[model samples]
Target: MTARVPHPPIEPPGTRVRFPDPVLAPSHGVLAMGCDFTPGTLLRAYRSGIFPWPHGDEEDEGGSPLVLWFSPEPRCIFPLEQEPHWSRSLRRTLRIHPYEVTVDQDFAGVMHMCGETRKDATWIIPELERGYRELHRLGWAHSVEVWDTSTGERELVGGIYGVAVGGAFAGESMFHTRTDTSKIAFATLVTKLRAAGYVLFDVQVENPHLASLGCVEIPRREYLGRLDDALEVTPGPLL
Candidate 1:
């Protein structure tokens, strides 16, 4: 059975809270009030469309108090009902490459690779990695992987990972190694999500690639309204 998540009381606008440690709570939803950034605390935040991204030293034993909770305004969402716009060049590349797509396979590897390849400082620190891995074990988080079969070796070429609640998929991060690989993975995932009867694919933020894929921004108020509808329906596991 899935764990029960409780909706916490809303925090006042413009109020900042410093979260330094993770909170381990059985409730799989947001804590009403806390300054902890523990595994359970992050888990609860994601379930409520809030994510803790802290910036600080990688090896600092004391850890960092510089943190921010993000719930993006004008959230990006893909229109899965519309036909996915695969460019002719992309289609040609697909024909030549013929990559295979897998879901929920090598999620930890994907997360690790994402962290390892970080050129800049990363908020997905060691603790965050362990936390998400635990969430993956609990089936609250998942990854979509793209594979190159010709090499007979698989690397996490491109994919997206995020939390699922009811019929909503809150996209966290997506990375790609090959051209259009991430786009392919995203398009395919959107197709699968549509088949599963999901109503929201919260891309969280927008960029050129996501915009090209038909992701649009809506006001935060409108997004929460949509979230309400999305949480009412049941959808299948992302895997």
Candidate 2:
């Protein structure tokens, strides 16, 4: 049996549209459900401190999988100051590899690789990819890539991609085909954001992998407060 997500974002009465209010998002984190994942809706959701992720199965009574939106009560983020602590092995890997890191060279490649390289099931569906691709074209989304060209063909070993609004970077997903490649890409992104005066690197949720990268979680209210501050600066020269 599929365990329904608790306190899923409530739909408003008599309205076909859904807007997730950060101030009213439930403690369970989901803020809205069943909206189309278009560029406009996604951008609006991101600005409102909510993000969309759909259910893995098609169980909706209406025959469409719910496009569940979320704003976790304890939002995960990596403040620019608490930089990722690189382990000795990771440092060595970085030092030895001639990784060429670049920005926005191939956002779609990064996104596709991120989806294809996942070890388990992923929610980066085709709809999400298409929406993000459009966002990239509009300049609100960007990617950092770690390239390896020693094999005579241009190959992307690792990368990370996300949406940027003002001083906030909503990290979407990352993947690495080579050791420490994703780490290198992620570290580069954080450094660039810091230099560009960004304050928030929204990671969405915490896990052991991110914990190693110095990410932490703060309450939803606190995240919203900080989100306001992050919105003050412009995210530019996205390296």
Candidate 3:
């Protein structure tokens, strides 16, 4: 049976918050700060090519940690139609790896593991976590889970989660408890996205690990232009 997600009513008030123009943001891409994580607000920000990435313990007027929004320059992305380069070992693992892959089966569980596995320097703080959870419930966010079933009990060994808007996907975070499992989850995700007709796979930033998987960087202007095109395309169903 295909799993069905329950829908719940979300209030519309907080979504009305306005954000600054990302193009006008400073070189560091700190466009604006201070907004609640309402689904509407998040959707609007993403639609405008902006995303919240809160830092430190800075507080807003309401005494809560201020939300910092960014639209980075030299954005990192994975071309959906192109396959990443994989090592010979990784290819072999893909052929013989004994793990199960599932989608949206346990979004929260994936999230909890992502944070728990990276307790030091993790950015999936409490508020942001709740925000993504709400987005998941509303069908805007999704997760890809990798499980180890060898013990006859399914253990979540790796996973990735992100928000999808139209034909664009913003990969937020991923984690792995076993070697190469995260890479396995990532490869599976790219295949699924390409099959689903997704155009843009936004990694947000460049890292050595991602570069190893063929993620590349482009100027922010180019990213925004591509984002516009991606948003205009009728999004294929991805669940």
Pairs in steric clash, model 1: 21-37, 21-38, 22-37, 22-38, 23-38
Ranking of predictions according to lDDT = 3, 2, 1
Q: What is model 2's C-alpha RMSD? A: 8.2
TM-score leader = 3
Q: Is candidate 2 or candidate 3 better by TM-score?
A: 3
Worst 10 residues of 1 by lDDT: 4-13
Q: Estimate each model's TM-score.
A: 0.76, 0.86, 0.91
- Across 1-239, the per-residue lDDT of candidate 2 in tens digits comes to 11121121222223235685877777778777774766667766777788888666543568776578888888999978665577787677767778788888889999999989985536777777888887777677788889999988779999999987778889999999988888998888988888877889999989899989778899998988888888777655664
Expressed as tens digits, the lDDT of each residue in 26-65 for candidate 3 is: 7678888774687888888888888888764667888877
TM-score of 2: 0.86
TM-score of 3: 0.91
Candidate 1 lDDT over residue span 56-125, tens digit each: 4433335544455666555678766677677787667656667888777777766766666556437667
Task: State each candidate's clash count.
Answer: 5, 0, 0
Rank the models by TM-score, top first: 3, 2, 1
